[model samples]
Target: MTRYVALGSSMAAGPGIQPRVAGSPRPAGRSARNYAHLVAAALGLDLVDVTYSGATTAHVLTDTQRGAAPQVDALDGSESLVTVTIGGNDVGYVPMLFAAGLPRPVRRIPLLGSKIRSLVNPAERYVALEEVGAALVEVGRTLRQRAPRATVLFVDYLTLLPPAGPASPLSDHDATLGRHLALELERLTAQAAATTGCGLVRAGAASRDHHGWSPDPWTTRFGWPVPRRPAPLHPNAAGMRAVADLVVAAASG
Candidate 1:
């Protein structure tokens, strides 16, 4: 049997979606419907999905959490395909988004506002970008050494907001920060892919038209209620399918 592994953060884990991977002691929050499983089924391969919500590059390279092994350890140089969606958490992207969406009462507090501003600060954002960049480089180098024959592909994050600027519902400050981070994350991923010789899947570009601001959004928003589940700031079913198409193509071709 060919070893096909999936690694990364919540985006790769597919939180809030069901028939989750059962029997795991850890709260993996993995969805069987995630792009990894979808792509594995499309390619008829057994998927060893080790993706967990809130995982960082450090978690991928080393065992940052108990019970779960380092993501790279899942690769034993025998994988035929490996897909990773990471780096966003390394840069504090999700926390920034959630903080930006804080209620008015919380934002009214001086200390809270100041902390949020620090996260939105350009200098701070750039510092995180640099850190994630270095981590990506190490990630690329490690994967090449471990899974030399596997078709390693870095699946970038999906589009969360509009390209022009953030839409309504998001505060002016939050909107600005959201848009900036969205574009910067993609750029960082591309740079890593180029440096590592790993195949790049333009999941973000493919998701542009399907952004949460689009007429038909592929991702959920801050407080929107979807039937039975709420995967806010994460990709919806259609979005996952679209990303699966990109991955399948890359793995097959």
Candidate 2:
């Protein structure tokens, strides 16, 4: 049977959307419903889900929490395929941007601007992107070294802009920043894939039209709800299903 490994952050983890036991930290069940599981099941593959909530690329490379094991560990004696969805939380940029609102021209001022810019600026975001990309490359290289015959697939993040309705307070700016951030993430993903010889899967592009707050068959909310709690900005069940379909298609191809 083919063997597959999935590595990445909460999106990969499936959060509240993926059914789990009462106290289980990780999402329970196979990738059957989750994109990873869906792809693996379709291919009759053995899947090792190394995905964890709140995990960053650096954490995946180095951390040793129960749910968050090292990506390298998941690839030990790999078989046919390896898929990854990382680099979303490297510099804590997304959360920070969501908290700080959009990029206003006033934020360009030196002191306050530095503080806000640190939270909103594209340049600062790019720094985090670079770190994430480099880390992904390292993870890819290690996976290749460990699983020489496995096809390495790096999945990019989906877009989070153009929300659903009229611009709410701070929605327009946040959406704009989200668009730019999504593009930057794609660039980083492409760069890492190029360096690591991993097959690049543009999952983001697949969700572009359906992303944001608009009422679509694919998306649930706009700009992700606040409180950052159980079901915050991550994908809902429908979203996960869409993700699963795209990943299954990518894996089959």
Candidate 3:
């Protein structure tokens, strides 16, 4: 039997996928519909899913949460495949990008406005990029050391917006800033993957046509309604399926 391990944050956890397991721990809101689960099912691989909702590279490498072992602990040299989509939380991209949606009046406050602007300033973005980039590099090194025979594949986050044009729910400015951040993240992830000799699944590009702006979106918009939980900027059921296909292909190849 092929041993497959899935690691990372909410993108791997599938937060809003219905029928969440009872007593499923926070951060690790593991859902059967997550791409990881779907991929495992499609490939007939034994899955050890340790994905959490808000994990950073640190959580995967050393930290533990909600009584779960560190993500790497879920790995052993016997593994045949490992898939992960991490690094976003390390740079605080999700929350900061959402800040773009602050009430119009609140965004007028000088101090707050200045802070938000600084958050996207080139220097700040570069610093964040460098920090997360280094963490991902470390992740690659550690995974190789820990799972010597495993094929490590680092997946990128899905596209949250279109290439051009303002998407609903975000001010044009915010939409532009969000796209910029996503681009930076992809660059960092690709760089790390190349450095580590790991496979890369460009989930962002694969899901580009299904961005929130699309008539048939794979991912949820910032404030789209989701039953029983706050809207997370995560892949919906369709998005999960799309990602699973990509992952399955990579693992099989």
Candidate 4:
């Protein structure tokens, strides 16, 4: 079988998903059914998924998290495919989104209070956009150099908020602002892909109608559960399958 490598953040690692893959870094929340796994299964590829829940671009290129090696370190010249879904954490997208969509009471909970407070009022809407874009470009360059023959792809983050107007929990102001930020990040992803000559899977655009509040949501909405949900405000199992199909189509295209 061909070798396939998956690298990214929680958006890709899929925390709280069912039946986690064994031998994966538990802290990374590697799911047995993440798009990478599904893509590998569909393509009959041997997968090395090192996607971490809190990963930033640094984690993909150079840094290690929870004792796991840098994501790019998993690559070798033998791999045939590599997919990367990252950058939201670098710009504090998901973190800030969670903070913005929460009730004041939930935001005040000690565990979430400090974290939310720290991000709720950043000087800018999205943090470090230029730097993150540069890092993403570097990630592409490194992947190409490391596995020259492999087909590298960049998968953008999925849609989390509704199109416009106030959905529950999010104020109208927040709803509009979130859309702008999501668009900015999606643009950044496309920019990175073009700059690095990497294939892109427009998961964000494809899920526009499937926001958490949509009739059929591919993402989980914000909720503070006692045990905490597997992937709050992130992609769900259906989303994973959708992404896997996208990956397969892109790979086979």
Q: Across residues 149-192, which tens digit of lDDT does each residue of candidate 3 receive?
A: 99899999998787898776677776776787788889988998
Q: Residues 1-253, candidate 4, lDDT per residue (tens digit)? A: 3999999999998887776888776778878988999999999999988899999889898898888788888987898999999888888877777788777777678877877766666455455665687888888888888988888899998898887766677777666766777888889889988998889999999998998999898898877632335677888899999999999999999
Clashes of 4: 1
Report the error of model 3 at residue 24, Å: 2.7
Error of 2 at 71 (Å): 2.5
lDDT (10s digit) by residue, model 2, range 197-221: 8888886777777654545734333
lDDT of 4 at 232: 79
> For residue 237, what is the lDDT in candidate 2?
62
Candidate 3 root-mean-square deviation in Å: 2.5
The residue-by-residue lDDT of candidate 1 on 76-182, one tens digit each, is 88889988899988887877777767675675678888887776666887788878888987887788889999899999988888777656667787777777777
Q: Of the candidates shown, which would achieve the greatest lDDT relative to the real structure?
A: 4
Candidate 4 residue 180 C-alpha distance from true site, Å: 1.9
CA lDDT scores, all candidates in order:
0.82, 0.66, 0.81, 0.84
Name model 3 segments beyond 4 Å from true: 107-123, 228-230
Candidate 3 vs. true structure, TM-score: 0.90
Model 4: how far residue 118 lies from native, Å: 3.7
lDDT of 1 at 183: 80
- TM-score of every candidate: 0.91, 0.79, 0.90, 0.92
Q: Which segments of model 4 are wrong by more than 4 Å?
A: 105-115, 225-229
